[model samples]
Target: MLLLEGTFPFVAGGVSSWVNQIIRGFPEVRFGAIFLGSRPEDYGDMRYALPDNLVHLEATYLYEPQDNPPVMPVHAAPETMPMVECVHKLFETDMKHPDCAELFAGLMDEAGPDGKVSHEVFLYSPESWEFIKKSYRSRCTDPSFVDYFWTVRHMHTPFWRLREVAVRCPQARIYHAVSTGYAGILGVLLKHRNKRPFILSEHGIYVKERKIDLYQAQWLKDNRSVFERDPSRVSYFRQLWIRFFEHLGYVTYQAADDIVALYEANRQRQLLDGAPMERTSNIPNGIDIQRFAPLRAQRSALPPPVLCLIGRVVPIKDIKTFIRAMRTVTNHLPEAEAWIAGPEDESPEYANECRELAHQLGLGDKVKFLGFQKLTELLPKVGLVVLSSISEALPLVILEGYAAGVPTLSTDVGSCRQLVFGLPGEDEAIGASGQVVRIADPEALGQAALALLTNPQAWQHASEAAVKRVEKYYSQDMMFERYGALYEKNFKWQA
Candidate 1:
């Protein structure tokens, strides 16, 4: 049996999709999912239906305060005493301190040969809290140490509870973490305790994605504590939160037996952060080609030269860039229509900004903001699909566009070039499906899209090439085979 923690049965994110792929890939292994959440409301219907291979499902919420606090020794063993000192240092210093790196490496070196990791590292250490309070007062001039201390205390209190929960879980041979977050850390802890192998797979870089969210998230600002000194800098609370995420990332990298990433960029980051190069692997995300195959058969009733953009309306998606491109595209092809097929009101402020840009550009109805609709129903209507996202990692939308026989014009990010042009005949020519433009460049995006819409013969060549490329390199079956091998090899973890 394998214990799968955190992402699978809980959150509806890229990590959750990876969790589903793994479970669905291996049916023989009995997998138990330990879902961790902070609040009852956050635990929804788990939109990704649990697969039959899932033998056990258990959930723990961090928001519920523990009924009984575990006791910690005023002093620990000699071997463990330095860990206490390390914890104090960790809680006191900001992330990126070279000392933090040395201390974590030293702590890992101190783990017992039996792999019995002491819980003292995560549990409340009086020495650590005292240092934290003292450092909090002196260093955190903006937010009073009193406020920062409580914030740190609240964010980390869950790790202690997670430790207790892991100890109670049914013994499993392998531990797989969907991503390196709190739940991933629990998997690390469990593997150390049981001496089992731990495999971590990440679809998107969690800490990086979380950092993006944290920077834009309004909730942190609403509750920011008053700092007595310089208030000019960004909120101290946000800084503390980012540091915590950095710590989690570093810890996850240090402990994993193997680490997986969706792209080369993310892999490099993991290695740079602390993961050994040998332990890291890149496995691009997979899509069910069969699902889109049938959809491709149904052609659009609309006329040719239709350009569509399919993605969330988030700022990162750069919907504004797409709208800007639409303004220039209309100059050559008056009959051509560009459809912005996604949620229009993701961020009311951002949405308003997009609409205002369109109005200023004088494109009254040239770019239509259609609300969210099923891609299966909408994708066929479009001939040329555009992805203007500034940041991405093997977007599933592009794959869907390919499978639907719709050529794409995407920003040069993640695996776009590899997806369009098959890697030099390790396989034959898997035709170039679309053009890759520099991100955030409206004119280049417009020109590339114009080429596809204007030339039918060129479009045909690209579409055929796209189908071959997907069949050769981006096939879901190929992905399943690779992941299946990885899971099978580590199925029987040694404790």
Candidate 2:
């Protein structure tokens, strides 16, 4: 079973593409998937056609409104109060307490039928209320107890929703979660319930990304007055949310039999974040070289002065940074044009803002929003592939570009630097495939593009390096072989 959160059928991005590739790559294995999303309205039609081997697919929305049970004063069982106190202490210790796994298992047990710490008990039990109040009195610095109350309530509501999903999910010999968040927690629950092997493949560090989201979230209440607030300190509510996610991530780490990261740095991060060293490994993303290799012949001998950033139009992608870089690119090469070839439906506001910024910079027709385009058709015509994301894993686009004989210019984020310059040994000997600039630096981004596009010798060297690196290292067959071995090992254990 594959536990997915906000990726796959509903969304179209690198992770979704990877999921599609994995399902299609394994025709013999019968697969089941559970997709968790925020709400029905947030997604459109299915982004990818469901594969035949995917025998079962289920979707649940976490934020969907349900009729509330009647509010009644209830008292928690005496045994549950101790468990609740331990839960709070678990968070206090940053979920590194020796008893964390045991504590989580106990909590999961109590979430069962007529159990003391079930959802209803959490909602209306007087012991639960007193525990919340006691924690607020001791830890909350913010003035509004009401805000704290609602925030705590809102934060935990999803746990029950996920629990329900876990209860009904189809059984699989092994469970695979693409990232650690709600889906990871569901993986934890299912692992405990079924006593099955659960594996995690983290494309981006979930806790770190959630921290970024919580830090920027404007809707989280900060009741402190300007004089009382410290500009440098994060708001109490934001910190609360961060800790909550950290606790969730830590539990997920403990539950997973094997933790997979896209690269070594992230694997180390998994260790720091509580994944056992023995259980963690690295599995970089890969693409089909054969699919894109033919496009190399279609490219013009004189590369076009076109730069393309192919991904979702989300804030994390930093579309504005790409737009600002185009302003610089056009100034250097008058005929240069920037093509943003991805779906904008993910964040229409951000997309609109990017378009407005381009207009304000007088880019006019030099900047184009091509929505979504076929990479086979798009790559052959483009001179350079650009990635201006603030965060990423091993982006497949770079490898795809390399296979099509185009070099990439990307920010120094995730494994982009490694992908561009190669790894330490033979990978490094392949030579620098492209350029890597500091994140959010438009001037550096544009200048780097100019350096590659204007010089044919330099561009050819980068292109050759790109093709060699991807062909040798990041091909789909290599990725499939590794994953197939993993699945086979678990399947034998199941037998």
CA lDDT of every candidate: 0.71, 0.90
Q: Candidate 2 residues 1-495, lDDT tens each?
A: 999999998899999999999999999999999999998999999999999999999999998888655787777889898987887787686477766865786687677547887788888988889888998999999999999998888888887788888889888999999989999999988988888899899999999999988888989989999999999999999999998898889988988888999999899899999999998888889999999999999988876899999999999999899899988888879999999999999889988999999999999699999998999999998999999999998999999999999999999999999999988999999999999999999999999999999998899999999999999999999999999988887777652
C-alpha root-mean-square deviation, each candidate: 5.7, 1.2
Model 1: residues with Cα > 4 Å off, grouped in runs: 1-15, 42-44, 61-82, 88-129, 137-143, 217-239, 300-304, 330-374, 422-431
Candidate 1: give the clashing pairs: 142-227, 431-465
- Model 2, position 408: C-alpha lDDT score: 98
Whole-model alpha-carbon lDDT for candidate 1:
0.71
TM-score of 2: 0.98
Question: TM-scores of all models?
Answer: 0.77, 0.98
